[model samples]
Target: MTGHFLSFEGIDGSGKSTQARMLADHLRQAGRDVVLTREPGGSAGAEEIRRLVLEGDPDKWSAETEILLFTAARRDHLEKTVWPALEDGKVVICDRFADSTRLYQGITRGDLRGVVDRLHDQMIACEPDLTFVIDMDPAMGLARAKGRQGTEERFEDFGLGLQERMREGFLNLAHEFADRCVVVDGARAIDAVAADVARITMDRLSPDAASA
Candidate 1:
């Protein structure tokens, strides 16, 4: 319980990945024991799942299949990477976790609430101390995504409508986990977003996360 786990959530092109790395670097500079990683791609087995998932199309991946794949990856990541570090009191910064499954696979793709919950219980059920939801409009978000033409992954290849629903998914998640989630405007500048994240990091990890 002394260790803190923070997750960065948002639609594609919302700058969450960037912010996660930046925050990790800041924490490291501050002399914190921080271990940076991402869901579905942190461990070797999980990363392979990432490839399968990203390459999966809307028609190919059923809701059940997607959730199963996510949990499989999550199990490997937790066992191989996340839990061990957290046991050592390291601050774990994951790019995305179960929320991504809830959104992309559960909410957007179709209905898999039952499946998602069951898998979470079965594997990768750790709740984060805090989750930063980088919010943004779908169109604007996709425009930013288009900028990454060369590196677009399967999930990042979602169309505008899918992106929009994902945005809603994120918003709904922030609402559902209000006490454990912080919503930031991803539309802001990188440093600006980083500053907010840094301030939050200081507030929580330091003796002040619950205070100013």
Candidate 2:
């Protein structure tokens, strides 16, 4: 219960991957036992699911189906890797978690409230000690995402309107989990944003502000 489980969230356009790694690197430098991993991944089984869900160009899976895939991978990740890492007292840094399901599936899905409620209540109860939601525009996010290596996956390429709704969903999530989540401006320079993230994480991890 005293271990730190931190998660990073944002739309595809948001620079969470960069910031998450930056934060992890910063934590490592400070001598913290950090475990950096991402969701829909982080294990062999989950990686296969990630490939199918993200890389496969499929129009068959509905929103609910996608949500189910994510949670399945999530449950595997928790049981096989994340939970063990936490028990070992490592500060776990996850790129995405159940939140993505709510944003991508809930907001844009046909049954928004229902999808959100089910996942919130039934699936993910072990909320992170801290969750940083990097906020940015969908158009800009897709552009930034495109700049990353390789071609856009099915999810990354989902249009700007979908991205906007995803952003709104994360914002609402932030409001709902204000004590643990803080929306950091991701539109800024990558290094500047990284610095802010590091600062926030460091402050929270500091002995004097351990409960932060």
Best by lDDT: 1
Which regions of candidate 1 are displaced past 4 Å? 56-58, 206-212
Task: Assess each prediction's global lDDT (C-alpha) against the native.
Answer: 0.83, 0.80
In model 2, the runs with Cα more than 4 Å from the true position are 149-152, 205-212
lDDT per residue as tens, model 2, 1-212: 44578899999869898888988887777777778899889988888888778875646578878888888788788878788888888888999887787777776766665766676677656778889999998889878777775643687666677778888889999998899898999999999998888778767664632222
- Candidate 1 per-residue lDDT, tens place, 8-88, comes to 999888999999999888877767788899987899999998888776454667777878888889899988988888888
Ten contiguous residues with the weakest lDDT in model 1: 203-212
Candidate 1's error at 205, in angstroms? Answer: 3.4
Error of 2 at 17 (Å): 0.4
Cα misplacement distance, residue 150 of candidate 2 (Å): 2.7
Task: lDDT for model 2, please.
Answer: 0.80
The best candidate by TM-score is 1
